[model samples]
Target: MAEGQEKPKRLYQVWKGSNRFFCRGRLIFGPDVSSLITTIILIGGPAVSFCIKVNHTINVNKKDGKDSNYWYIVLFVAALLTCLDILFLLMTASRDPGIIPRNTKPPESEEGFDMNTPSMEWINDRTPHLRLPKTKEVIVNGHPVNVKYCDTCMLYRPPRASHCSICNNCVQKFDHHCPWVGQCIGLRNYRFFYMFISTSTILCLYVFGFSWVHIAQNKEGILKAMRKDILSDVLIVYCFITVWFVGGLTIFHFYLICTNQTTYENFRYRYDKKENPYHKGIGRNLVEVFLSKIPPSMNNFRAVVCEDDMVAEAPSADHVRTSKEKIDIEMGDKFSESNGISLPEILQNLHYDDLEGNSKDKERSVDFDIHPSPFVFELGKRDELVIAHETENIHQV
Candidate 1:
């Protein structure tokens, strides 16, 4: 509030999701950032050993008056692959994973709903009050698909979008939350994530193969050759185990890419059982995943947001009440006072069968008060109305 003082806070400082920001908010990471440390150790440790072994092999070849240039090339290729793998890993981890911004409140407008459509009719008419449907039918690629409403995000998830529980945010075109990368794989960074794993597979194989070559060149038994350079044995075992992980991941993701499916969808939806509406041919799927231009991030984490825009002590989506729910609660309180009955007692006594039988009689006995207003209203106007109502009640008291 003072002159010459910073009044606004950067968006990252007040971000509600369990994400970490770095490089002045230019990079975003998930809650398990420490996983990246393990990744680095796994990569860098083996690379150092590989380089040392290759260099030593080259030196022995030179001392024996044999061509060492081949070994030099092998060392160079291994180093290059290691560096490339690390670069891809960083790209996948730091970039935005296509997080969708959270709404300040649940949407009140009937933008996506059709009240007059017979298909929208409730299956259960026994309910006391109307509530939003759990799933809505959407058309994707000329086929009707049902998309579930995410209660935590308070929105219908876009086609292929899902909420990452680890990141605590809804991501567009979500693949999965990858702990190895310490990031969610989604629309923005999934390409890089795939590249990282594939490159890692290549690097592991490269090291594994050359480590064997180093052992074979000794022309001794396997045990004697391994005893001569224990690092080679260590690398062989390490890369062998590592290849199964990263290599298997590479193949699995290749299948996903070719099929135009995400890990989340492949596992949960099981497109094998049903037709995959998103499947273009394999060629087109490859182009869509690898060659398509990525969209820019929805959030500007470094942007300074004013106090009015900042939602201090913001409630989670589950705790935040919708306008309809608030109205129902207030009406319930008023009804309880008038009838000299607690809200819980009234609820316990209310029966669906009785309501169905006495619907016509209750309509005659109960006088209804209703108002017509625009479905959408400005937040400022809503705040003003709330303040005025509170002031009137204070005066009465």
Candidate 2:
């Protein structure tokens, strides 16, 4: 509250996920972002070696009265691809991956439950538990799908949404947690993730193909040429090995994009066995994945929020029951003193059969006169009190 004191910390500072923020929460990265260092070294190191080898080849060719313009073009293209791949990697890792906001408490609405059909069971002396089903059926694409409730997030996950255990947050259209980029591949960043892998594959092949060409320019045999430039030999081997990994990933993701399937769903659900609910035609699927507008992030990581308001602890069942008991006791005492009849006597004398019969008969005759009281109306509003009293009697037995 002091005028000279610093402002409260932003939401990113107090964020629950295992994510790091930079530029005052303008940029976000997963906890494993250090893995990107290895990725950069693998891609950058090979590209740099390729450029050096090409430059040396160009110099040798120029001295032999040959045109070295072709080598210059190769070098330029290699450098451009390397830069583009790095940009894609950064875009994939540094941006939000469509994280869904967490709920402070379980939803209290009756939309998902059939309250009219009660499956109540009396177990010994304890109150009947009003259990809610874990999975709710939702209609998606004209087919019924079961959406599970997440206890940690306190919500039913939307279609294609899943919780990433590493990030400790629910992500929309979650693909998988990619350790290479140190981020979750989800709706917001999957496009850049695909681009990063595809570009890396191209860059690796470029270096691999050019390094061999640099060696072949020698007048000697292939073995002799490789021996002369050891760096080019190393780059050829490195690129050859790396291409398999990145190239395979690129091809796999291309299939995923065409079929409108996430890596998570493809492996777990195995849509190959059954009809894919999400699949449209190939053209429409590609447009949905790549050309669709990405949804905005749900969290404002840099926004200022009150410290007290930030901690929304859900009340326990026992705590709620205790509070309700206190209210019932207080209301009962007040009602008993105002009206001559005690609360228990009024409840005992109330006959549901008589009330039902009176409703059926238009000109009904009553044996006893009924007086409408504000306390009776107040008691009618507290239905939980009757349940609590019945539970107490059961316990006494």
Each prediction's Cα lDDT score? Answer: 0.66, 0.64
**TM-score against native, each model:** 0.73, 0.73
Superposed Cα deviation of residue 370, candidate 1 (Å): 44
lDDT of 1 by residue, 1-397 (tens): 8989986789888887899999889889999988998998899999988998889888888898999889889989988998999999999999889886654444333222333332222222222132343443434544445444455544445556677879988787788999899999998899999999999999999999989988887777877999988898899999999999999999999998898888987776557567876788899889887887776676889999876666323334455445542221100023223444322221122111112112434232221111001011123432110111100101000
Candidate 2 structure lDDT: 0.64
Best by lDDT: 1
Task: Write candidate 2's Cα lDDT for 237-257 as tens digits.
Answer: 898899999999999999998
- List residue ranges in candidate 1 displaced over 4 A: 4-6, 108-130, 311-397
